[model samples]
Target: MHVPDWLDAARQRELLEACRRWARPPAGLRTVRTPGGGTMTARQVCLGWHWYPYAYARTVADGDGAPVKPFPAWLGELGRRAVTDALGPEAAREAAYDIALINFYDADARMGLHRDADEKSAAPVVSLSLGDTCVFRFGNTETRTRPWTDVELRSGDLFVFGGPSRFAYHGVPRVHAGTAPGDELGLTGRLNVTLRVSGLPGPAPGGGRSGPRA
Candidate 1:
């Protein structure tokens, strides 16, 4: 489901500012390297659970090995509202979401076709967009090739995929450069924040990592 302009301008600006803070330190934004030995152009940072090739961890085991950041309470609240809005009150009632994967995209950054299959939870994945617009390629569960839909995702848009489409393949194939109201938001790129339920056993590492910038 795609809910256009779900965040409004004020919320977009606020989330962008929060992204800046999360992009620093030991567990800060870093490039993702796939198991096949290729690096993703879009840099990413995670809260509650750090993700690697195809697994989740409490530390940036693929980058700095620092303890992952905490899943902020405010984010949890926001996610609840999002899920409630997307899947109704009943679905949101039992949702205890605790993982967020935030990605920062430059003009040239593009995510290839892929599927989000690391989570054990069947709950929906809530996605929020900020900054520049992009062509989101939402594909099928059977393959990365065609029979897919290309949706233009702009700033403040909310996209939720779950139920039958929960494990479907999806990606950002192109980010229209400079399309963002950069002068107003002070961001020249794109930011995609996805809230998910990890459903992993054990709590995240109780420690935090802070120090020199990444």
Candidate 2:
């Protein structure tokens, strides 16, 4: 479901600013290379759990190998509120959003049809969009082909999918360049922040465990 203008101007500004900081150095924004040799046009950064082509890790094993930035509590709270607004209070109260994947899309960037199956949890995925609008295709789990809905997601839009739709196939087919929110937001391309639960064991205090390989 799409909740248009779910985030007010002030909230949008705040998140955008936070994203700028999160996109810098160490565990910062970087291109994602698929195992197949092609690279994703959109650059991304992960929090809580680092994401590679097909799995999640505690560190960016594919990048600088630094530990990922911790997921902010404030962002988790915001996600809970979003779940309550989009799903219900029960889901909001139960959501344990510990991971965030922030994808940056330029004009020519597009995500292929895919399902977010790396997460072990069955919880819903909450996506918050900022900057330019894009055609977000929501498809079925069985295949990447037809019977999908193309939703035009603009800045401040919130989309939450759970239940049967939780594992559905989805992707961004196109982004309308130069359509970012006014300069006051300080965002150029599109920024997509998706919050999820890792469902994996948490690291012991002082880092007692290593993430399993893919």
Candidate 3:
């Protein structure tokens, strides 16, 4: 429930710049209505010294297991700091989160209610918002039925869900247009990078996970 505005403009710029450099639009970057009745477009760009997913020597844009955004280690560390600041270092045990799916949302883009269950690890997922804003819908674990919470997600804000809320059903129902940083940054869309440690056993091998792949 803690949203940190601690990431200053400079830090935010640093994150956005790094993300752009490693941007890789997934094969499905085009507009499509998801099962949850919302439209969305996204690209998966890998980050770090290695390209990711593949984890080969050179970081290439095309390959398996490639990261969507290679945010600097320092930035990830900052996310841990935010977690620690909010929930303490004990909760920051997994500071070295390595995979993220950078989701780009246009004006009409929307995401249906779902859960982040791809990763084997139940560690917290740190989501950073850049450009634009939308209604982030969160629901309970039982089913996508009634009883839910609507939280507005803005630029430069962070949302971490672990512990009891880790497997909570969540999604984006609406995205306001022209809410992201423009061409000056060489980007004109809403970017959301969610960092996590993946490749673990969950509900099932390829079952009900609700996040994009590496």
Q: Top model by TM-score, which number?
A: 2
How high is the lDDT of residue 135 in model 2?
96
- TM-score of structure candidate 2: 0.93
Put down candidate 1 lDDT per residue, 3-104, tens digits, no spaces: 888887777878888788889988999999988999999999999999888999988999999989887767766777887887788777766778989999
Clashes per candidate (backbone, < 3 Å): 0, 0, 14
Q: Order the candidate numbers by TM-score, best to worst.
A: 2, 1, 3
User: Which predicted model would earn the best lDDT?
Assistant: 2
Candidate 1: Cα lDDT at 156: 87
lDDT of candidate 1 at residue 101, scale 0 to 100: 95
Which segments of candidate 2 are over 4 A away from where they belong? Answer: 203-214
Q: In candidate 1, where is summed lDDT lowest over 10 consecutive residues?
A: 205-214
Order the candidates by lDDT, highest first.
2, 1, 3
Q: Using lDDT as the measure, name the better of candidate 1 and candidate 2.
A: 2
Model 2, 43-119: lDDT tens per residue?
99998899998998888888999988888777777788888999998777768888889999999999999998998
lDDT of 3 at 165: 86
Which 10 consecutive residues of model 3 have the lowest summed lDDT? 203-212
lDDT of 2 at 40: 96
Model 2 lDDT on a 0 to 1 scale: 0.87
